[model samples]
Target: MSERVVRPVGRGFLFLDSHPAGCAAVVRRMAAEVEPRTPERRTALVVGSSSGYGLAATIAGLARYGVDGIGVSFEKAATARRTATAGWYRTAETAALATELGRSWTFVNADAYADTTKDDVLDLIAGKLGKIDHLIYSVAAPRRVDPRNGETYQSALKAIGAPHTTKSLAFDDGVPVLQEVGIDVATDDEIAQTVKVMGGEDWARWITALQDRDLLEPGFSTVALTYIGSELTGPLYRQGSIGAAKADLEQTALNLAKDGVTAMTSVNGAAVTQASSAIPGIGLYVSLLHKVTALQTPVEQSIALWDQLTGETPLDLDDEGRIRLDRWELTDDVQSAVRAQWESATQDNIAEVADAAWFLAEVRRLYGFDVPGVDYTAETEVDVEWPTTA
Candidate 1:
């Protein structure tokens, strides 16, 4: 068979953000090129392991850094429609890749919002590794199951106005058409329900359960992802129910430290993962951030997280222990620029400001499939393996 040389220029294709491989790429770059680490396999527990930053962190912990990890997620192998969600396929593919690289990858399709998930993980750790050295919390879900009552609590994202309009490229035509988005005025009870579902409650539960099981070892560090963006995303994210949940997460990090998981922390990282896309008004912000950052910083310089947790390079600290990924992007200067441009942006001005078209393409490329010249039309099945209980 003649080898098909498909050189992927960078991250995923526009509009399609493949969380798994994009995450894997980030981890590989961070571990090897950006923040280098000592090469010894360690045991890790990664919740939300099938998607978004959680998946990326998992890839870094397992594949790139060669850490053995147990991933806890409710990622269905196939979505309700029987088609693979981006996260489901990505996680499955990533687990296979990690196995080939000699790293253990366990994927548990249990809800992270459950008490039993942690319990089961601890049981596995006891049988195989006996302890978890590092824990990474990266769960992004629109709802949660009450492990207490088994009631499903769903969350809502605040959309702009009664029904606001935004621009998205019609895949068939590259033209940016204004898309109208609906606002779901979540009730007060709904807000509370959302918070309980997405907030730090589940995080605390996980930590407590692991501690009760004595699965967390000394020097055990943990970090949960958070995002506090500028005014643009306030209605949809920062001031929304999800934002409130994130605030709770940030607070939980401090409590985790005070309680002796001193190495535990929270990361308010960059704004592009799958989780961000679900939020309203984020596409514009992300497009702007990517555009401006690319101009202000070189591609390698844009490798923000690489310099933080991984001991590869010197650390860059913010006022808090949290990494300043979106903070800088959402700064007064940057946000102002983006806000002004967003106000005046017409389809004609897209290429000038930040191509929403390009944004979609990059997101699609994360699936490990294509760039313009890369052909994946034929089925190429690579036998994949996943961690089994150990």
Candidate 2:
């Protein structure tokens, strides 16, 4: 093996390399915060369990619920001259943590949208876990290849009815710049394609496949992570192409209910994530939200979600039967403050009005940079082993 200093590499909001040590450190920190609550040996299947909320859910399952199962994600392995994706290291670290906890988990590095991947995961579950108590669907990808039709569908981030313009925070040579971003209205094909890639079709198929193979335990339940931003971001998010996809996801939850599956949509709070950074106006909104509200980290939110799902008290649901974890983020005080800042925020006063620095730092942390106590200048191992695989 070789050792070298792996600094953060990329331009603007796009990153080219991920530090293996940093990713492992972040996963360890998230695992440390979660106190194991139950010794119950439950089995779970976490799709897209490599980064962001999916990674958080997997850690919570292992640390809080003593869950032993499979995590599926698509990640690139490290080459001689190139680093692997951040998810690769994150999943490897998660497997290490699970081992320390005396839990067994397998990592399947493959496209979660493919039928062959699903069949392989089902076989793994049957051989290793026997049954699944929970299935967490937290996939957020730009494009997906339809397993049945073999056609590719790419999700778009654009408004639906009319062109929407808003103030956004852009990065100039790693500095935060206030700018106006206009998102044109999406075409009909774009909307449909977004829904196809980001919608709940794959989620439903996973559930059906598990049921068909008798892999679902008696009280089997599933949750798909989603977001319904406040009206400030409605035009580009809650009312945009992504919004249409989320609507389909929510409707899928209802349809699953009709089929007696205990499935629900989890409306997570806005946070700095690799997926959210791709949205047009989300960076500014999330920065402002962080400035005003004490937002929950993805791991914290996932822990709370697991608590809600397994707590002694009844599960709280909105009028539509979806869990509202964004309640803190959408509070009247928080939104009002963010709106006031939105009107007057400029590059000169961005640091005071919005936590742009925090936003940038969080984004850096997503790719294993800006994490505490990790010496970015020191020579580090670029190639790390994935702890477990199926």
Candidate 3:
């Protein structure tokens, strides 16, 4: 059994106020970047909108911009025996809370890689919200079925040419056990498949489909989130199969720009998320990285990035036209300190060099656990309804 809490909330009540309270702080800062919106004419669409940056963007859109949005995510609901995915609860809570505050939102649960999902989303946007003014692509999946051919492509997380060995941690008998793990290199075919699954294909498809239907509003903007870590984890991330996908995504952004919408990739610092936890060697790397950098949470970073993208600055972009939000994580001093810790890290010393307890708490928070003010002992409503529109 996996040691991590995949389902943190059982039949217990989840404190609803803390999440929006946390989001509101980020929104107050984000308000500085948001131009006053003339409501009733704006709509936003977010793919993979149930969690992480997507969820944050959704909340910011509602709370900061007061924009109506249609969100698409594939998350399973709770059952009698099995707990629901955290995203499900988060989405429900977000919708319920936003509605109480006079916001309009809709969540479509569907696979983003499917043409059918895109079609359904376009219909929702056309019917409920009119046209989309902003689109956010934040889907992180290991496998994708090509909508054109129905062939499945799976992504891999590995070095390109050689195996990278590192000291890692895993839960054994409910105790943290340190061990040495070697991740092998990816073959050429594997690399290609990984790129195919994880790259910008689906994003382009959604944009083009919207364009064909004349659903994208004039001056629309879209962004996809990516990550590029330090050299220590390059083999597993920045120079690996997923990196290839991100490079292709960057190219796709350039192409999309030609079609008149602002499209770009925002590189973010590593954080503990459901998708990220599955990446090999990332747990140890992120723990040490956090200790050295003291990086902000994803929601904080998302608000900052949104400010840059939507503020009067006209979307600051690098030479490659991509947003660089990982500056803090890649600073010379932070990387140097992290490198030093990496060199000294061992099974016995990892706990000392890295804030292991903080890392665990952060991971738990992702699944709606360990939040400081949330009363876990309270009785929760397992059948919370999606918030209704105004």
Candidate 4:
């Protein structure tokens, strides 16, 4: 094994390197929070199950319900001179722990948006697990190549109708700064491309593929994770190109339901994630939210989601037949407090009015830095392998 010190090597939420030990620590930490319930031999398929809410859902299934799972993700492996992605190490550690716990697990490193990957996963499930109890779709990608047409479509983060100007936060030489940012409206092609890439068409395709293979269990359920932030971010998020795509995703669930599939969208709360950090004004909003409220981590929300999906209690859905895990984050009182702080926040008083430090730390933790028990100075292994078992 090769040993070397791996430090984070990116700026402003774009991490280039990941520490294997630190990623393993995060996986173990999430697993420890869950109390194992009665053993059940259920099977789950988590699309995009390497990071963020996807990873959380995978861990919850393994730790809480003792379910065997196949996690599908597209991540790079480590080389002789470079470390693998954080998701790589996380998946590796999860496989190891799942084996120790006697729960069968497999990590498929392939393009989730491809038809062949679906075929491969179906074959694996047919050979290993008989049926799928749950399917979690939590993909957050910037671009997607349509397998049918071979055209590449990229998702845009631009506004919908008109140019949107807002106050945003950025880091300047490791210090937080307040800046006025503006995003121009998306063109017609841009909106269509964004919808094509981020919308629910691919999700529907996955469900159809599983059905064709007779892999869905009786009473099998599926959910796609979504986010609808408060009006503070309405112009750029709720009314933006991404928002249009999310609308398509939500509608897909309804369509799937009409066709006799148990599918629904789960609106999750906002937190610091690599995808969220890239959005305009989200960093500032999340920082303010952190200062005012105790936001639930992704793992915490995933555990709650699992409870609602498996427990005796009925799920509390909104008028649109969707799970609302973002209730606490979008509360009237919480939004009022955040707005009050937003009105008075400035570069000079931002540190006092918002939790910039906490935001930075969370970003660091995304790539295995700033973890509580990890030693950054110690010699660490950069090359790690995914556990393989048939």
The regions of model 4 sitting more than 4 angstroms off are: none
Lowest summed lDDT over 10 consecutive residues: which window, candidate 1?
A: 1-10
- TM-score, cand. 3: 0.87
lDDT of each: 0.60, 0.89, 0.72, 0.90
Better of 3 and 4 by TM-score: 4
Q: Candidate 3, which ten residues in sequence have the lowest lDDT sum?
A: 10-19
Whole-model alpha-carbon lDDT for candidate 3: 0.72
**Higher-TM-score candidate among 1 and 3?**
3
Q: Which pairs clash in the backbone of model 4?
A: none
Report the C-alpha lDDT of model 1 over 123-200, residue by residue, as the tens digit.
878877778877777777777778888788887775423433444323235444434455576667767777787777
Better candidate by lDDT, 1 or 3: 3
lDDT of 3 by residue, 242-342 (tens): 88898888888888886679888988778877677666667777888878777766666666665665672456567887887778888899889988987
Runs of candidate 3 exceeding 4 Å displacement: 1-41, 173-176, 386-390
> In model 4, what lDDT does residue 151 have?
94
Error (Å) of candidate 1 at residue 232 is 1.9
TM-scores of all candidate predictions against the true structure: 0.78, 0.98, 0.87, 0.98
